[model samples]
Structure formats: C-alpha cells, structure tokens
Target: MSQHGVGLRAVMRSAAFLTAGALAVPALAGCGSPDPAGKPLAGPDTAPAARDRIADGGTLRWAVDAVPETLNAFQADADAGTTRVAQAVLPSLYRMGERGRPEINPDYLESAKIVDTEPQQVVLYKLNQQAVWSDGREIGAADFAAQWRALSGRDSAYWTARNAGYERIERIERGASDLEVKVTFKRSYADWKSLFSPLYPKEVMGSPDAFNEGARRALKLTAGPFVLKKVDRADDEVRLARNPRWWGRPAKLSGIVLREVPREKRAAALTAGRVDVAEIDAATAGRLAPHEGTVEVRKSLEPAFTQLALNGAGGPLADERVRRAVARALDRRELARVVLEPLGLPAKPVGSHVALSGQAAYADGSGALGGQDTKEARALLADAGWEPGTVTEKEKKEKKDKDKGEKAAGPKKDDDGSEEADDGTYIVGEDDKARGDDEELAQDGKQHLKQGGAPGAYAPKGTAAPARSAPGPLAKDGKALSLRFVLPSGPGSKTLATVAERIRRMLDRVGIRTEVSKVEEEGYFKDHIASGEYDLALYSWPTSAFPATDARPIYAKPVPAADGSLNVEQNYTRVGTDQVDQLFEQAVGTLDEGESRALLRKADARIWAAAGSLPLYQRPQLVAARSGLANVGAFGFGTPVYEDMGFLKKEPGSPSGKASTSASASRS
Candidate 1:
C-alpha cells in the first residue's frame, strides 16, 4: 500500500490484502466512521455464517490486478500482492480486528504480551505447538529469530525497505521451549504487536541471500491453511491449495486462485462466472445494481488513503513553497466528491494524514498550511521568482526543444487494483467538472504564504521578483515552472490516470506545467515512485492501525547507514525532517493511546508543513463477490480470517453458486 500506492496490499507493509507485482490495494482502514456506541468499525459486509454451514472443497476464482513480484514481503520489489499472497500461505502472529486493533491469530499464536519494560523492553510470545511449516519444521523460535535477524536492519546485505518495529529489536531467543519466544528490545516499542505478523520460515530468513532474493522466487515452505501450489504466470494467476498438514480449522475452500483480471473486465468476469470474488470501483458497483442477483457489491472505507506525493528530493519541490503551492492548487473536496459521491457516502476530503475522519484521534491537519487556493499557489510561485506571465525566450525555446518524439515510458504491465492502488480514493475524472481556474483566481481571500527558499542552485537568494499580473507559465532563471508527473497505465489504473490528468489541468491553471510520464505498472513503484524519479505522483498508502509504527517509516528522515546507502526505509518521497522523526519516535515510545495520538498529531502538522504528501480522502473498499461467498469481501478494518472464506452451504435445496441470489448488505 510505492507508489503503500507507496501502496498497501498492505501487509505489503510487511504482506497482505495487496496484489503487488503491479502494485496492490492493501486492506487497512486505520480509523473509521463508526460511532463509539459499539457499532463495528469496519462494518464488514461479508456474509457471516457458521463454518459448519459452509461448503468445502470449492475453489475461489479471485480477481487480483497482479500477482506478487516476490513471495517475501520484506524484499524491495515486494508489493501489496506479496502481502495478500502471504495472507493465505504465511503465518501471521497477529491480525487486525474490526476495531482497528491487533488481535492474536490463534492459528499461529497462543499468546503474545509484554513482560518487562524496566532496563529494556521485553516481549514473550506463546506460539501454538501444533503449528508446523509444510516441510515439518515447527513454527517456533528459529523462525522468529531468523526473521528478526533479516528484518532488524543490523545487516545492510538484507534488502528490507521497511524495518519499522524490527529496527528496535535488541535480540530474539527461545522462551521456555521452542513454542515460546522471548524478544528484548533496544528501545521502548509501543507497537511491538506490529512485528512478525506474516512470519517467514527460518529457511527463508536464515541467510542474507535467501532473505533478500529467495522469497522473490519461491516460498517452497509455508504453514497457513493454504500452501503454495503454483504461480501460473502465463495465466497471470497465483494458485493456492489447501494445506493437508494445517492444524487449525480446515480452510473452507480447497483452493484460491488469485487471477489477474483487469478492472474494466471485472463486472463481465463476475457475470460470466469467471471470478467468485473481486474488488471493483464505485462505477463498476453502480452498474451491478440492476443485476444484483449475480453478485453482491459491498462497500466500506479502508485504513488506507490515497494522496498526492511530492518529491522533495530535488527539482522545484525541494522548496516547501512549491510543494505547498502544488497542494493548494488542487481542489481536494471536489476530488473527493467525484470519487466517493458515487457510493452515496460523505464526500469530504480526509483531513488528517495520521487518522481517518471518523476516528477519535482524527483531527484536521491540512489547514495548518491552508485550504485549496489557486490564488495562494500563484502567489507562492511568484514569491519564489516563478512569476506568472514571465516565460523568457530561453524558456520558450527549451520547452519546445524538449517536446520531440515522445513515446510511452515503457510497455504497460497489468496494473494492480486495490483500494491501495486506487490511491485509496477515486480522485477520478471530474473532467468537465475541473474547477475553472479563471474563476478561482478571482477570489478575494489570499492565504498567508509561508515563503520558502528557492530550489537549490536554481537562483541566487535575492533575485528580483517579476510583475505578477497576467496568467502564463512561470519562469525563473530562464526555466519554466514544471514537474514530471509519473503515473501507472493498465486496466486497474484508470482512476489513477484520470486523477493525474485532472491534476495536470489544475496545475496548468496556476502557471505550473506538468510533463506527464506513463510507465509500466511493474516498474511504477520500484523504478519510479520508490526511486524518487518523478517530481510528483498520486497514489495511496494503507494507513496503519499503529500509526507511530507504520507512518514513521514512510515519513522518517533519510539517514546514512554504515554502508553509505541512504537508509530511506519507506520514506519514498525523499523528504523528511528531524522534527518529524522525533515526534514519531516519541509517539512510538509512548504507550498511552491518548498521548501517542497527541504526538502523532504534532508529527502530522509537521508533515503538512513539509508538504511531501497530501492526504486526499478515504479510499472506499468496493468489493464484488458472487453471492453466497462468506468471510471475504470489502474487509475494512477487519483482516480476513482466510480459513473462514467459502461458499455458503446451499440452504437445504437452495440453488448453486452460479445462480445464487442475495441482496447487498445495508451500506456501512
């Protein structure tokens, strides 16, 4: 959940609800609109039924945008698909409950609790003794120790882009027996539960080479209810067969085929009975209402949100003013309306980067800088010496010279579509709906501009500001105000493409020109988004239940490691401040929920000031599944319990799955 869209298939944080070779949609709804009076936070819409009432030995033809690039979630190339694959095959010690809290997964964990805080933090894990990997290796201390070594960041050889809680690990050892593990921490880690959720085997993590590249190729060993059977790349599918050695409840379905079906083809696949379960966009769901008997579309907001990520590593955006200028240029509220209004949900922009609107910790951090104001954007650009109506002959010639023989960036790969990949919100074609810039520029209110330094080596400190009267491309030192906007192209990326196009027009009005680059989905996150090869990108990241744990990596300052490699972890934007890092450190170390929320709020404000990324709105979870499917569909805050998913038993003499009929649940 790169592009967490720096995407979530999130588990992609580590595996997941994500489908990532192409990028993924992670299923994380950090905070939600549920009332405090006991309503389910995720408001899960999957049809619930007792396991005994569910049919067994059925196959779930799942539609995923892409298969995982790597089986290991820790690998640099791993995406949300990596996480989603692990969801069924790997062992996660803890899973997210509907309240957006961690709940122990009894399949692998018996109990996990903090036993000490004095001197050093320590945690004791009680694993289920019955749990064993496919090859008869017990799921115990070896696995935990190996994983800690691989992910703890002590060894630079291991390619772990995200080492959140693992970085704080001091040591991991066997507790009383192989079934129990004792973990000691170098620092206080309030979100320790976040670690080792989708635990890999000792065989996979025992060595750096195996840890780094082995998982990307094959995870021959697994312990979950389902095990790896085949990765049918020719068919764009990852197939899983039920594990015969599973000790917990037998998986209700015999196998799950995660097929790569394009978003546009989703409805047809559903109607044709090709896919039993799939995630769809609001438009797709809207079209399915007339034929609700074929599939029931469920909707909910996920823990993740989509955003406009600014690359502050270099170019014009290195200046916070330009970043904020771009932020103010877009109409977030209207964008939210274009995406979410289709679902009959509230169409307000998500206010905080740290939390969703309905959650208790949620607070609007966007206003600390200012609201949507094209006028302010123009002023900020002008103050930075990129005055409107001032494009010099040199700039004009350069712009013309750069526009020859343009070609698509690369052959397009199938784009992964998850709420995470949707950048979490549609932010789609408000085409004719794009706000008229001429009208917006005429507004009287002028936001206070926090003027920032010019881009490094762009111009001297006191360059004369040109007259800012008319509208035209801004220029500074003979260079026009422009940015490289990288976007993904493929079936699942229509929303992302539309949003990018719309954003292009919005920036155009404020004298900022965006050079659009369309790249293959396979390299979108790895080669572009994560590599910081573009000035601006729009994507989604699944917000975490543990904000301090997850958000820290995404926003932490890039530091130099012993190997001299920039240890960015997950801070793909290449922009961070010590203040932001310190706030997260304080928040993660602070165990009290209220205090942590306060610290995170401070961090969110700093992030807004940094203007590395702008949270747009909650990405709605739109899942369409054949009727009678249970325990899987639009899981909001709730992590799927893979074993419980299946077709409901034909009620006595009910019709088969193809003709199965049911109405959609009440909108959560």
Candidate 2:
C-alpha cells in the first residue's frame, strides 16, 4: 500500500497471485536473472547509480490495459487494474524487496515482529504515529479485526476470492495503545506477512454490505503517498495526486495519470509521445530496442508461467491415464518453440507449478510426464481400455460421410456465375490450395496453429490431413476421447488461440479430439475458467514470495457449498487429492527454509504425476520507458515505490522530456 510502484498492469499481474495463502522466509538472492536465450533481464532501474540526481516534481503519464471493474483488490472481480490503483491509495504493510523477500515498509508501520509462538502464533505491528486515513481516523486494531472477519471464510456472505491462511487466525486485539495491533493465529503460519497486506479501513471491511457497495466506486479515504483524484471511465483513465495529508516523505511527483491502452498500440503510443511508459512483448521489444530515440526497453523474467489446465473432475480428462497420455503426446519443447522462438526468445518449457525457471528453489519435474512420446501416449490410451483400430475405422467413415454432406451443401452461384460463400462467412472462389509449411486449423473450428494473428485469429488456411495415422481415434465402450478447450477471445487472446491450436494438434496426434471454445476476455477467468465449465483451459498463475503457502488454494480440494455444488475458488483443475493438501500444510508449517523448499518440490512432483497441467514457460516481463525516467522500471519481484518515482527534469520543448496530460480515452 505504501505506493511501492505505480503500474497500470499491476492489477492484472497480481490477479494470478490471488489463489492461495502466504508463507515467510529470510531474504535470499533474487529469483529472476538473465538467461542465455535472451538479453539481460531489462527493466527500469529501481536502484540507480550515485551520480544520478533524483528529480523533485513532475507529472508521469502511463498506459494500462483496461479499466478496473472495481477499486477493491479483495473482491472476487478484482484484477491487475485494481491492484495498480490500490498500490497508490492503499496502505501496504510490506513490499517485495530487492532480495525477493518481504520488507516492512516504514511509511505505514514503525515495526513488526513475531512476539510469541508458544501457545498461539502472535504478531505485533506498531503503526506510525502520523499514519492516519484521509478521514483523519487513526489506523488501529479494529481495522485489522474487521479485515480478518471479512476475509476469514467464516461468513459466506463476504464473497471473498480466497481464505486459505486467513481462516487459521484465532483473534485480533489491541496492544498498549491504539497504534499497536496484535494478531494471534490458531496455528503457526509461516506466511503471516501476506495478511492485511493492503490493509483496508473498517469502513470498507466492517460488513458484507460495505464490502460489496464500497468497492463499486472510487475509494473515498486513502492512507498512501498518493490519493485518487479522478476516475474518468468515459475516457478510460485514472488520475492520482500527491496526498497532502500523508505523514510520510512527500511524493516527488505532483500527480500521476494512467491511460488505458491496447496491447498492439502501446509501442506506437510510446513512440508518438502520448505516454511515458509502456509494457511491450519480446517481438515489440526487438523492434524498438535498436532505436536511439527517447524510448528505452527494460525487460525482466516474470515469476509467472503459462499452462494448459486439464479438468480432473469430469470428461475424458477425468481419467489420470488419459491426462498423462495427453501430456506425453504434446512436446512442451515444441510448444515453447512455436510460442517463444518466433519472437527470438528462449524455447525452454517450465516444469513446476509452485516454482518458476529462474527461482532459487527451481527444479524441473516434467520428466515424470515421460517426455514427448507418441508411442508411450498410445500405450497409455490402450491400457485405459481405448482401442485405436476400431475407433479409427468408425471415425474415418464418419469423416467421409461428413465431407460428402459438406460438398452436397456447397456454395451457391451468383447471377454473374460467380460462386458465393456457402454460409456467408468465408468468401468462395478463392484459392483453396494447402500451404504445406503453414500450420493447419482443427476440423471443429476450435483450434488454429499458424501465426496468422494474436489468439482468436486462428483461421485454417491449409488442407486437412489425408490420413489418420499416428494414433487412431481412441475409443472405449463406444465413447471417443474428446475434450473441450475454452480460451479467452479479447484484448490478450491472440497468443492464447495460437497456443490452443497447437495443443489441439498435439492431442489429435495421440487420437484425442479437442473442441475449442472461445469466451469473452472479461468473463474468461470469472465465468468460464473459474466456473469449471471446460474440459481443458489455458491460463497462468503468478508465483508469490511465499509460494509454498500461496499455492494451497490452487491445488487444494474443492470446498462444498451449502447447496452441495462444488465451490472452487482458485483450484480450477479440481485436483482433490489428500496427499497434495497434506504436503501443502506440511510445507507451510515448516519453519526451516530448506525443509520447506524440499517439501514444495515433493508436492510439485506429485502435481506432475497427476498430469492435470503442464507448465509451458516463464513469461518475460518487459516495460518500455522514455530515457531519463528514474525510480520507475520493471520490478522483477517487488512493487515499485510510487513516491520514489520521478523523471530527470528537462528544459521546455526538449526531445526526451516529461509532459502534462491532455486527451484521455480508452483504446481497444
């Protein structure tokens, strides 16, 4: 909450980390570093050289992907946008430090420590004497108690997204004075720093009604270095000004403005002098890095990774052998090649769910999936009672009949004797020849592999395969091995579509049929994926500083609702194994860092054996900033302190100078 860094994409990026609880450990070497496949991890330099002087005052205009649906970061609908906004206006007790560990922020709290762990885990926090809300209310133990009750999962009406570590809290009480707060846990929690992170005021967390309604509008009272000045939904921009009542060090900038910009237009926006900073991908970075203009590209390896989540509760994925077979058939290396290599990036596939490639505790366990072996895949399918020969004959006959039906319903001729499109979707009479080098789309229109456009632009331009060879259609008891795959179809969906198409091809090679479903981007996570509506899905999870505790909700068993329906919060895969849950608790309860790391590694091995998901690769966190911008860059593991961010002041009408805000509008 002490505005560590003000990033428009923080909300979306932080959304991936909301699934689980948090744990703790001493500071260690950072997790991310430059890899051989790419350039040194680039981003804004948080720690600058001594000779560089910090600027006093200026306005910084930045770009964000979308407008936030709500201002509350605790709500179920909160996303990256929410976190970005919250960072400026909320009170974060701790921030991720340079050592990739949680560092207490002195701006909000004077000190915090583990006072006792004998009878119950007790943590004491001393609030700064000057720390008070915009409403002039002192931050106290009541606010802490209110937040714990709202997020503890004790009241179903709260509608919280996660309650993993919070439910273990026993009580919250005031110490000697209103400035002191003591929190007692029912159990010894290692990741206690994750709690009350962006501590909310009692006005917001006091009741279910307040939690629901207060979040719908802009925050009224804030305690951070910056305060929300304006939220222009009409123009897709949020404006913040330095908080006059803030007791901490005065913010260097007079104001900060965040504009909502599309992914494709960010580079252009930075080039056109419309914004000061923009986050670009590797392809965009390559294009802009050579330019010696005012713009500079900063890149860092993100702690997040992408994956194909296979549903374990129902459908073909319900069987563990089928899931393992699917994992074996698809070459993850080939996947990395198709997705990352095109952009001249690394083609290494991530192997663990809990740890990323560059983390200190990282280890690859994907070998348990047996590498890419179509032979092994077929054998697994055969062992699961699915016969390849019989299913192949029936599938071939069905395709033959379907092709005849499609030819019979061919396009109609116009009055000019030109053939018209059959269904008025695609134009006919054009060349239908196959592009041998290009990837083909699936027969069901659900998947595409070619690099046509971003995610949803996968249109098949090549001919279908002449023969169903490798592994014939897998069938058992008159049922074919068919799975449904759902992906987003909005702002950032182009890559997802491409990945989904490639996966569809891999599954097809092992005689598994996949039906691809496209959902709107806004509802992709909340409506489709989180609801468990697909047999398979594509998504990413952000790793937390305390990964062992934070991953509990993601791999934990689904808690049941009062009506008996599955109430899955972050465990979208629906992996309900008691062993995974036990391992998570053991890791979280372990105080020794080495023991915790070992336990987490064991848990990850179990996850791979389950075969519900295959980690693809670590995503690169890239941000483009104009030269002279200091204290604002890509933070690999920690939040950027907003108060510390400023640009080197330039004379009027200079080439690389900061400017004031003008027109504000949303771009698709």
Candidate 3:
C-alpha cells in the first residue's frame, strides 16, 4: 500500500478507540447541592418551573467579540465561535451525531445519500423530500448550489483553502422534492466527506448575485430553533426568539440574548449575576473557588494551541546546534508548574505540528521538544566557540570610567532643585558624552576626525570604538542571539507575558538576551506575524471538528511578497520542506484512516526535529454559573446548550409532582 493508505488506516484505529471510550463512559451526574471543595457542581433532580410568569420572560444575555462577516458555512474567514452563535438561529441540513459523526436530520432534510465518491474528484448529495424554509418556501438542491457558489464566488472575502475542494464542480441539479448537488474536484482527495455535508436553504439565500450583496444585512429568515429578533451592532448585542415555525422539537427557552463583553469584565459580571454564564480566566477561576456552590466549572478540550515558533530563514538560528541549545535551555516542567498548573489543570506539552488527540501526524512523543538539558546546551554553545567571561581591555576601561563618572556627578537636580527630573528623562555626564556621540554618528553619516576634516569624517585610527562582543559561546559572526517574544495585549495576554518572562530568565541564565512586547489584537495577526515583521511570537490556534483539514493552513509555507509581507499561511516558523509537504498531501489524500495517521506521525516527527515550533500546553475551558442553574452540560469546544438546562425551586404540594387523594373528605 502507498504511505498515504497506511497512514489513513492508523487514524481509523485510533478514532475507533476514542469512540468506544466515549460510549463506555456514562454521562456525568451532578450532586443535589454545590460542593464546598470547589468540585464540579451537582445536577438538579427537579424540573424547572412550568410556564410561570416569573420564569417565562427574561433574556439570557451572553457576550462575544463580533458578528461573523459571512454566515455562509463554506467561507473560511467566518469566526468559528461567532458562527456557532449564528447556528443557534440558523440550522444546518444535518447535525453532528453523539460520537462526533454527521447525521442527516429530517427537520431540514428527510434523507441524504452519497450518489458518487471519487476522493476529491466529484461527490454528490441528494436532499430529502420535505425540507422547507421558515418562510414556507421549499428547500431544494439549488440552495446547496447557491451556497457553494456564494462561498467560492468572486466577491467572497471569507475565502478559505477549503474552497479548493469545490473548484472542479460543473453544475448542481435539482430534482423535484429531492435536491441533487454535484461537486467536482481538481484532484483526488481522501477527506472529501469533511467538505460535502451541511446544506443551506436556497429560498433565503436567493440567487447567487443577490446573496452576495444582501446576505450580511438580512437576518429574519431561518429554519433553526430560533430566529433573529433584533440586532444592535453598535452595542454588540443580538436578540433571538424561538422559531414557532421550526419543524423539530421546539426550543424549551423563550429566547436568547447575546451581549459582547470584554474579557476583563466577565468575572465581575458573573459575580453580580448580570449574566447567566461567563468565561473566566485562570486567575479569576482561583478567586471564585471560595464560592464553589454558586459557581460551576466545566473542562473541555480547547482547540487553541499555545506554542513558540522558530525563525528558520538562516539567521542566528540557522544551525541545528544553536537551535537545540536554545531548546535545551528551557525548563519545560517549570513552565507547566509555574505557568499552567496554577490555572486549575495540568499542562500537557506537545512536540509537533499536530495535537495529541490528532491523527498519526501527532504520535506519542516527548512531553517537550528536547526536555531540560542544561549540559547539552552548554556543550553546544562551547562547540560554537562561545567563550566564558572574555572581556577586552577596552571594555574594562569603559566600564571603569562609567562607574567613576557616576560617583563623581552623584544625582541630577531639576529646576526646583529636586532630586529627579519631572519629565523622567535622564541627564548625561562627561563620561556618557562619547557614548552619546557614537549613537548620533550611528544614526547619521557624520563622524569625528582628530585633525583634518573630510566630507565623511573617519574616527581617529586607533581610537575607533570596539565591536560589540557576542552574547555567549554559542554565537558567531558578531550576531547577537536575541529573541523577541510577542504577546496579545489583553487579560489573557498576561499568561503569555508571564511565560515569556520565565523563558527570558532561563535564557539569560545561559547568556541569551530576550525581550517581550505586547501587540493589539487587530494588528497582531495581520501585521506582526503575517507581515513577517516579527522574529517570534506566542499565539493560539483554535481547533475545529475536523482537525485534519483545519490544521492545514497553520503548517503551510509562508508565501513571500514584494512588500516583504507574508501571506495568511500560518507556517510562522518559516520552515518548509518538500518531504514534509509530500507527507501532508498524502495524509489528506489517503482514504484509509490508519494509513493517513501513520503518515501524519512521520510528518510530525520531521517538523518537531526541525524545531519549527514548540507546543507548550493545552488550556482547559473554565466557565462560571450560579447554583440555581441545572442540567448544564459542557461540550468539547466550551459552548453550553442553554436549552437543555433548567432551574430548581421549592414545590408547594407533592414532592414528585403526584398529589394524594382526599378519601376522608369523600367518606364524611
């Protein structure tokens, strides 16, 4: 069998094991009351109040960043989190089964069948007989066709790599109540099923041209459990009402209200009972633990990944020795204990492009890249000719003169004879004069000459400033082994900053200089890393249900541009190899799950060995809620289904909703 085939088979075996495990485990039951030890809250035994005025009319407010640019499913740039909220109002043709498998729902589509499958070539989906839109319009194959065209159409700003799968399609055909949608592909693709499902409504989408212009503004028409009642863009709030026309089990809740709240304000809002549920940071989670009964904690697999990217364009880190040395200098265990463990859960270090739960590309490996190896680090640096404490006579003289001048001048005085400057600017003394002159000369072309003056004056022959010494024994060619760690400037950004500081201290112990900087969210992804203007950054990659396809963009090569900006591809490490690319292609193209996974493992090993990136740990999803809430279950992605939840109250009569007969009164 081909390598791709082998890898695909392996992935299937692993997936099978995971599926079995999920089935064997019973659903988690909650205690009757909250636990004082901050353990998970117990489930409520009693049902919520029945249609009472006190419980009937209130908006369950939630928060998020913004509305998705494209509600269309095929569009790549659609924020997954935002789309999930929209999905509550807009239903998909099918929903994921309990085991994370896709199943056709009769509410939207009575049945669906795969008419043809030739890997990536062409696949067809036949819709059900009775699928209809909320506006009382029939949904047919044309809807699916229009939705794909809308996503892949010329004007789509949300275009994604997934679009490439639909490039070969010729046309979609509609047949009476049954809709036949045909997809043609440019090449044979093994994971075609990941792209083919999920049909949208045609009547609401309208014609391709019309949808391209109006999809963003129109919000009322939908076939889901809820319909959009009001949208306040300026205030970042969206109100939803249960869809009376919904064809399935009606939503239990009256409506839902989504509000956008900043990360910092979520904890306070949860405490004040302004919101039913809120996402809390690690530190906030610790602070709220004392009130365990009122707050509930749910842990889920965050699709996000935190890691360090290497710059492999042949600068200071061009050699493997230096790269391995730097990796060895890091104490991964301390990072987890000090940085991640405090947040509530243990940190699992990753060693490659793929996550632990991922397919073969991410097989069992070391917890961290190389583990902690200080001896190996020093040896590598020594091999690179890094000297220990080698200071030239000139440097010694400069240090002595600088110290002497500082003592003689003492402290500076302000105009009011105060000790310090009001503006916080430093004053220079005679000993600092030469250093300032050198800095100015470096900025401009002008230089000082001893006797004769020239257009471009030269420094007096022997009096030239000494070249800056290399940072340590590992550095060569006078290049400083410096790294800049870029982090997000938000509440969650603090975690990254702390990690960066620890790393800085570790590297500094081995003579490496490191700096940390925070960038705004808007420009962070687009300008800092995407523009190729940064050396290194600590960022997260949100996961999708389909890890195989969703992770493709992050490892793709950095496409260069004339203006020096990198493309949207996430290969931040700038390390791309023909072998690795071939394996990735094979893994995606292979039909058998097991074989695909094996190939993925090989690819992961190569990437890890190359030091392209270092995976730190997986973050747990922490959520806070009040004690009165019941039936609240968490999903792997951290989203909670409020409809399945209820509340507890004291019963006025029977304990089990059963009343006793008044036999004595009847006898009298």
Best by lDDT: 1
* Per-residue C-alpha lDDT of model 1 across residues 638-667, encoded as one tens digit per residue: 778889888766576665544344212100
Q: Let me know the TM-score candidate 2 reaches against the reference structure.
A: 0.75
Q: Would you list the C-alpha lDDT of every candidate in the order shown?
A: 0.70, 0.67, 0.49
- The estimated TM-scores of all candidates read 0.74, 0.75, 0.69
- Model 3 earns a TM-score of 0.69
In model 1, state the lDDT of residue 264.
Answer: 63
Q: What's the C-alpha lDDT at position 375 in model 1?
A: 76
| Pairwise lDDT winner, candidates 1 and 2 | 1
Ranking by TM-score: 2, 1, 3
Instruction: Report how far residue 294 has shifted in candidate 2, in Å.
Output: 3.3
Question: Per-residue lDDT tens digits of candidate 3, residues 230-302?
Answer: 6667766667777777666556556666667654565566665555555544545555677575556554434
